[model samples]
Target: MDRVEKQAALFNLPETIVPHSVLALGYPAEENKEPRESRYEENRVHFEKW
Candidate 1:
Protein backbone atom coordinates (compact mmCIF):
# COMPACT_ATOMS: atom_id res chain seq x y z
CA MET A 1 0.00 0.00 0.00
CA ASP A 2 1.00 3.65 -0.43
CA ARG A 3 2.27 5.84 2.42
CA VAL A 4 -1.05 7.54 3.05
CA GLU A 5 -2.96 4.28 2.97
CA LYS A 6 -0.47 2.71 5.36
CA GLN A 7 -0.76 5.65 7.76
CA ALA A 8 -4.56 5.57 7.64
CA ALA A 9 -4.56 1.86 8.41
CA LEU A 10 -2.15 2.37 11.27
CA PHE A 11 -4.47 5.03 12.68
CA ASN A 12 -7.56 2.76 12.25
CA LEU A 13 -9.27 5.01 9.72
CA PRO A 14 -11.52 3.91 6.89
CA GLU A 15 -10.13 3.99 3.35
CA THR A 16 -12.83 6.50 2.34
CA ILE A 17 -11.53 9.13 4.82
CA VAL A 18 -9.20 10.75 2.28
CA PRO A 19 -10.10 13.99 0.57
CA HIS A 20 -12.03 13.65 -2.69
CA SER A 21 -11.37 15.93 -5.67
CA VAL A 22 -15.04 15.80 -6.67
CA LEU A 23 -15.98 17.69 -3.48
CA ALA A 24 -14.02 20.75 -4.72
CA LEU A 25 -14.94 20.56 -8.40
CA GLY A 26 -17.70 23.15 -8.11
CA TYR A 27 -15.69 25.79 -6.19
CA PRO A 28 -14.48 28.86 -8.07
CA ALA A 29 -10.75 29.08 -8.83
CA GLU A 30 -10.58 32.71 -7.68
CA GLU A 31 -9.48 33.00 -4.06
CA ASN A 32 -10.17 36.73 -3.57
CA LYS A 33 -13.98 36.53 -3.71
CA GLU A 34 -16.48 35.03 -1.26
CA PRO A 35 -19.02 32.67 -2.80
CA ARG A 36 -21.32 32.89 0.23
CA GLU A 37 -21.84 36.65 -0.36
CA SER A 38 -23.50 35.99 -3.71
CA ARG A 39 -25.62 33.22 -2.20
CA TYR A 40 -26.76 35.50 0.62
CA GLU A 41 -27.64 38.23 -1.90
CA GLU A 42 -29.74 35.83 -3.94
CA ASN A 43 -31.58 34.64 -0.84
CA ARG A 44 -32.21 38.17 0.32
CA VAL A 45 -33.67 39.16 -3.03
CA HIS A 46 -35.90 36.10 -3.12
CA PHE A 47 -37.24 36.71 0.40
CA GLU A 48 -37.85 40.40 -0.27
CA LYS A 49 -40.34 39.51 -3.03
CA TRP A 50 -42.51 37.44 -0.65
Candidate 2:
Protein backbone atom coordinates (compact mmCIF):
# COMPACT_ATOMS: atom_id res chain seq x y z
CA MET A 1 0.00 0.00 0.00
CA ASP A 2 2.80 2.41 0.87
CA ARG A 3 4.56 1.98 -2.45
CA VAL A 4 1.41 2.41 -4.46
CA GLU A 5 0.37 5.43 -2.43
CA LYS A 6 3.70 7.11 -3.05
CA GLN A 7 3.47 6.60 -6.78
CA ALA A 8 -0.06 7.88 -6.92
CA ALA A 9 0.77 10.93 -4.81
CA LEU A 10 3.75 11.79 -6.99
CA PHE A 11 1.53 11.78 -10.05
CA ASN A 12 -1.08 13.89 -8.19
CA LEU A 13 -3.74 11.37 -9.02
CA PRO A 14 -7.13 11.29 -7.32
CA GLU A 15 -8.04 8.69 -4.76
CA THR A 16 -10.29 7.02 -7.29
CA ILE A 17 -7.18 6.33 -9.40
CA VAL A 18 -5.57 4.30 -6.61
CA PRO A 19 -6.34 0.62 -6.37
CA HIS A 20 -7.25 -1.03 -3.08
CA SER A 21 -4.65 -3.70 -3.68
CA VAL A 22 -1.98 -4.34 -6.25
CA LEU A 23 -0.89 -7.73 -7.54
CA ALA A 24 2.49 -8.50 -9.07
CA LEU A 25 2.54 -12.07 -10.23
CA GLY A 26 5.36 -14.33 -11.39
CA TYR A 27 5.19 -17.05 -14.02
CA PRO A 28 3.10 -20.08 -13.11
CA ALA A 29 4.88 -23.34 -12.31
CA GLU A 30 2.73 -25.54 -14.55
CA GLU A 31 1.27 -24.79 -17.99
CA ASN A 32 -0.78 -27.94 -18.39
CA LYS A 33 -4.15 -27.48 -16.77
CA GLU A 34 -7.66 -28.52 -17.70
CA PRO A 35 -9.55 -25.88 -19.60
CA ARG A 36 -12.11 -24.02 -17.59
CA GLU A 37 -15.78 -24.79 -18.07
CA SER A 38 -17.44 -21.86 -19.80
CA ARG A 39 -20.39 -20.16 -18.17
CA TYR A 40 -22.09 -19.09 -21.43
CA GLU A 41 -24.25 -21.04 -23.92
CA GLU A 42 -24.11 -20.42 -27.70
CA ASN A 43 -27.66 -21.22 -28.91
CA ARG A 44 -29.53 -18.86 -26.55
CA VAL A 45 -29.58 -15.90 -28.88
CA HIS A 46 -32.17 -15.26 -31.62
CA PHE A 47 -31.10 -14.30 -35.14
CA GLU A 48 -32.99 -10.99 -35.63
CA LYS A 49 -35.23 -10.72 -32.55
CA TRP A 50 -35.49 -12.21 -29.11
Candidate 3:
Protein backbone atom coordinates (compact mmCIF):
# COMPACT_ATOMS: atom_id res chain seq x y z
CA MET A 1 0.00 0.00 0.00
CA ASP A 2 2.87 2.38 0.75
CA ARG A 3 4.77 1.92 -2.53
CA VAL A 4 2.18 2.98 -5.11
CA GLU A 5 4.71 4.14 -7.70
CA LYS A 6 6.79 0.97 -7.51
CA GLN A 7 3.70 -1.28 -7.75
CA ALA A 8 2.41 0.51 -10.86
CA ALA A 9 5.81 0.43 -12.56
CA LEU A 10 6.30 -3.27 -11.81
CA PHE A 11 2.93 -4.14 -13.45
CA ASN A 12 3.59 -1.70 -16.39
CA LEU A 13 0.55 0.36 -15.41
CA PRO A 14 0.32 4.09 -16.06
CA GLU A 15 1.42 6.40 -13.20
CA THR A 16 -1.92 8.29 -13.35
CA ILE A 17 -3.82 5.29 -11.95
CA VAL A 18 -4.20 4.64 -8.21
CA PRO A 19 -5.07 1.40 -6.40
CA HIS A 20 -7.39 1.70 -3.39
CA SER A 21 -7.69 -1.92 -2.33
CA VAL A 22 -6.36 -5.41 -2.94
CA LEU A 23 -8.41 -8.55 -3.47
CA ALA A 24 -6.89 -12.04 -3.01
CA LEU A 25 -9.10 -14.87 -4.24
CA GLY A 26 -8.56 -18.60 -3.79
CA TYR A 27 -10.42 -21.80 -2.99
CA PRO A 28 -10.53 -23.32 0.48
CA ALA A 29 -7.59 -25.58 1.34
CA GLU A 30 -10.01 -28.30 2.53
CA GLU A 31 -13.04 -29.73 0.72
CA ASN A 32 -16.69 -30.37 1.90
CA LYS A 33 -16.69 -27.46 4.32
CA GLU A 34 -20.17 -26.46 5.51
CA PRO A 35 -21.32 -23.05 4.31
CA ARG A 36 -22.35 -20.38 6.78
CA GLU A 37 -25.96 -19.29 6.65
CA SER A 38 -27.50 -15.85 6.85
CA ARG A 39 -31.09 -14.65 7.01
CA TYR A 40 -32.34 -12.68 4.02
CA GLU A 41 -35.09 -10.10 4.35
CA GLU A 42 -36.79 -8.80 1.22
CA ASN A 43 -36.84 -5.17 2.33
CA ARG A 44 -33.25 -5.24 3.58
CA VAL A 45 -32.01 -6.71 0.31
CA HIS A 46 -34.15 -5.07 -2.38
CA PHE A 47 -34.30 -1.63 -0.70
CA GLU A 48 -36.10 0.55 -3.30
CA LYS A 49 -35.88 -1.95 -6.19
CA TRP A 50 -39.14 -3.73 -5.44
Write down the lDDT of every candidate, Cα atoms only: 0.47, 0.62, 0.58
Off by over 4 Å in 3: 32-50
Ordered by lDDT, highest first, the candidates read 2, 3, 1
In model 3, the clashing pairs are: none
- Pull out the clashing pairs in model 2: none
Model 3 per-residue lDDT tens digits across residues 1-50: 66776655555655666745545757787885687685757565322222
Question: On a 0 to 100 scale, what is the lDDT of residue 35 in model 2?
Answer: 69
Candidate 1: residue 31 lDDT (0-100): 85
TM-scores, all candidates, are: 0.30, 0.35, 0.42
**Candidate 2 per-residue lDDT over residues 1-50, each given as its tens digit:** 88888866765666777735534756669995786676767785333322
Tell me how far the alpha carbon of residue 30 in candidate 2 is from the true structure, in angstroms, after superposition: 33
Candidate 2 lDDT for residue 23: 44
Residue 20, model 2: lDDT of 54
Best by lDDT: 2
Scored against the true structure, residue 6 in model 3 reaches a CA lDDT of: 65
